[model samples]
Target: MKIVREARHRISELGKAAAYSKFGTDVARRILASPADSVVHKYVKTKGLEGSVRRLASESLPPGLYFAKLTIKQWEKHRGKPFRLLQGSSVVYGNEVEPPARGFPLEYRNIVVTSSDVTEFKLDINAPYELKIGRGAFTTPQQVKYDAQYGVKQYGDVFYSLRGNTVNPKKLLITFPGFGPSTSRISYAVSYLKDIKEADLRDTMMVCFQDRYLAAGSYMMVDSAGRSLYERVWSVLDGLRSEHNIDESQMLFFGASKGGSIAINYAKDFPQAHLLLAVPQMNLPYYFNKPFFRDNLFRNNAIRSSEQPESLLRQYFAEGRKIDYFYTNSDELSNHSLIELAHDVPNLTKYRVDGGHSAVARAALPSMLGIMRNFLHGAKNKTFRCENIRSYARGGNVLAQARVDNQASKIRGANWYLEGSLGRTKFMHLLTEHSYQFLKFTSDSQVLAAAYDPIEAMSGLTALEANGSRWTSSLPEPLTRGPKQSPGAVLSFDELVLTSTSPREYVVLDGDTHGKYRYRSYEVDPAGDTMEVHFVKDAALSVDTMLEANGKNRTSYVAVVEPLANWNLADLVALRFVIKAGAERLRIVLHDSSKRQMAMALLSQVDWKNSQVVAASPTQPEANGTSSAALHEKEALLSNAR
Candidate 1:
């Protein structure tokens, strides 16, 4: 029995070798002749299946076929037939189906189908089709149709589709699509379709490469040795150039997200090629560390290389290759470090627009087209700059200044305007020096200025107050006001000092009263003739003290006063004195019974001026929180002070 078993095993080995030779392919031969310890060898050994692996060796097997069981009769019948055999559904072949075509009739003449007890069969030989089987099912018809229409090619682990007229085309557009599942390639296809259709591609050839390894294996662009997957794309492009007689100089690479990174990677290679990237993930290593992708395959790959696109683009920048990059402020997936890197690249033209990573492409298509046209026309580089000229208050006028910088073009004129809830009003004309100043009515009002070029076209728009104030000066005299005084209360500072029962009521820095106030880096010297508060450091000095009136809270500081007191003083209001040391402006706050804080500013007309006095009316609270009589009295006092 042992001798018989040995003979059978030797005969089976010879049969396997003969099967490999008959296949006439290196891959088939290699897989068939693999060592017994190899995965393929072990698989065949355990499954008691030798013919199926040999037959499927020439073609890429669907993921499901790894564990499929084929009957001896089925293997004999289907062997050498060059067909796609799905595990459970149907066997798809080229142009012909065997007898007994079952199931409903189809519409297209090229495709034939039939169902049986064992399996179903389909045949379509007229068109080139992509067979991608996952688990136990064939890919969707939509994907198969797309692959058939466009000539899909698989290189390494990536599957890409290339479609366009290559005969004497004016340009070549290569698009690297964003990532998706292994079975689906339409997520980014839909994004590129609009651009592809709108693009003047009659003279352009477009190629789209899909990122398949992201789904099949968790392998990002880098290999185990930290090399980029872009090398493979380059090889493919080189092959296309050689076969189609294409010029690499007129190429434009476009991508978004992951695809955008690939576009940047190869932008330097083409030299003369242009790039249109939208919210690209330029820093792969940094992106992998993000919370969204920390556990994905991209993170795993990043651990190996520590590679980032910003670092890689340094060489590209040194080569002086420019790229047109579009990004939105709202893209959560985009890294700000990458955006800063792109902005720093002297050759790159950055466009910060509206929308997220995907929507921005559609939102900025019109601008993108203009940029593409300029590139094609070989127009000179142009940049736009608009900055605030610095706001100033002088001669009872609150002037807003805006400076327009047309880097390369001459400004014809500009329409200086103020935009607010009242609607836009064109107020002043731009000056010859490209600076315009207009009178702003309210101190809180913002200035909106727009600059136009020779064509009366708006070049740029800027808001003056966006970066706070560039200059600080006093407003008109009428804008400065002290707190309102009571109707008939009058108290002298010396008289109050003698009559006050609690010293805390009047915050005085005496010789032993150091902890009376919160002194922030300032000391009060009682030895001086008058109490002098001086800073130990050159920094600003400030002191804060809390006050209470009728169970309400109020806070007073050296630089500002926030009065929340609502005391029912029968006829007298308290008085506070502030002595100025510098020409800095002081802000004071007063609260109504509604608890709303209203700011009032007092400007110093001269430095080292005498002490200034401010007074506030005691609150006369009513059912509606404030009395009309008290409001009228307070308004009168404020009007008098102003």
Candidate 2:
């Protein structure tokens, strides 16, 4: 009976081996046999990171375990066919209904744990697909080690984490991280702790601002009856200067995008601090992501022109500040503010790269750190090709122009990458495949990336696609010459600017700040500046909520105002913003109905004063600030001023 049982067990083992052999053969035939089907090996080689990674195509291996390879574009096109995720990475997942907005998380999309069920189920996507998925994109950071190495220091709502040589450090670096989902570490720049140390940077003490005011950051510019975040940061930095015994000259300010803007703003007071900014959003008011940030940070949508890089950068006129703006030609909105600022800025070093706005910050980081290393050694970095990028908007179409001081340098034939608000998703459904055109050669100094708006009256109506963005190629003039401009009001740039701001307050872009370089736009009472907008109800147009609530808020106040100009925030990174107000709080909520948003101010915990009471002090700008001017742009375009 025992011999019979042993024979049966051997037979069972042989059967299992045969089943494995059969399944392996089937996987090889389906994936490795066909040239169309890439054997998605669960394992492939990579650099820096261990284990398998992904690239384009690879030769077939003796498939022990493999799946299929296809792109969302390929599968989406001929969808019914069984294919895979092929080209430039796009997540193929289930349960998640995220709009795949730019900079969205990837871990939730790709990862599954042991507690998960992997049984037969119909995919959400109405098509079939396969994948030889590599190890998931989820990994735990050494939190215990990092926690011991770093300690946080908070001042009011503004705070920063200090790391590196804290004991009598030679050089100091204050880093600011741009907009990243706060599910992870808010001190993202701290992740580069190891990288900066290994670069042989001197005994440097690094300061990484958490900047996680509401979500990610409020630009660290909150002010109340108490000391403002600015003052608190000032006190902290002033203490650090004495603690580290390092002056502004020996310190380096580094940031990318939003972080860069903050660094630039702070560095205005300390021009000696070397600045390394990348694709920074200089004009906060006109920023595409302003609504999300504004709603999160401000009490009202009153944006201060003072809260911009251009205003801060202009302060470096008397003294020289080694300001290096590591910018990518592709960052469209950022260029609008940066290019305009570059024209008048002195001792400004601009490093132009060819990459995306979000990606270029990280991509340019190594070079940015090298600049810090140079400061540590009191050396100069002359490696990067320096050039200035300028953009000119005429008849609603913008032309990105490049210039260089070096006659030997070729700016004409360099690659200039450009993308509009809609990026690649414009072609998502129409073409059944989605991608954006990024590279345009400076190969011809004459090459230009021009933006065309069909909706801009008859701004030629050259490029037209229903609900789609359009950027004309590197054509010298009117890209692929189409329609002639219809007779319409050709508004100058100043007029366009005037229309956006209040008529009563002529915002002098280059206003005199007496002596305070930090004080930005000064509202000079332009002789008899008044607007007759028959307000059925008392109303005022104010952007102060979006910027700073200078003085105290009056308890007796109007809850809301009428409409102003409507801003379309659906196309850019259309993340829905839901307003959750506390009891007895007044919040200006943007109810997105068919992509249209309500432009309102969040006037909670705010004190206001009537304009009639402050009429005596018309010249007093902060007095004018109390009488709020709110823009309401929901369905009807109107404004309310009180």
- Candidate 1 deviant stretches above 4 angstroms: 1-141, 155-158, 180-192, 216-228, 242-247, 290-292, 302-306, 341-344, 370-642
lDDT (10s digit) by residue, model 2, range 365-441:
44455556566654431222214333444442333432223431322212222321211111000000012122122
Go through the candidates in order and give each one's C-alpha lDDT: 0.37, 0.37
* Structural RMSD, model 1: 24.8
Candidate 1 global CA lDDT score? 0.37
Residue 139 local lDDT, model 2: 20
lDDT of 2 at 140: 21
- Highest TM-score: give the candidate number: 2
RMSD of 2: 20.0
Query: For model 1, which pairs clash?
Result: 95-125, 102-114
TM-score of each: 0.40, 0.41
Count clashes in each candidate, considering only residues at least 3 apart in sequence or on different chains: 2, 41
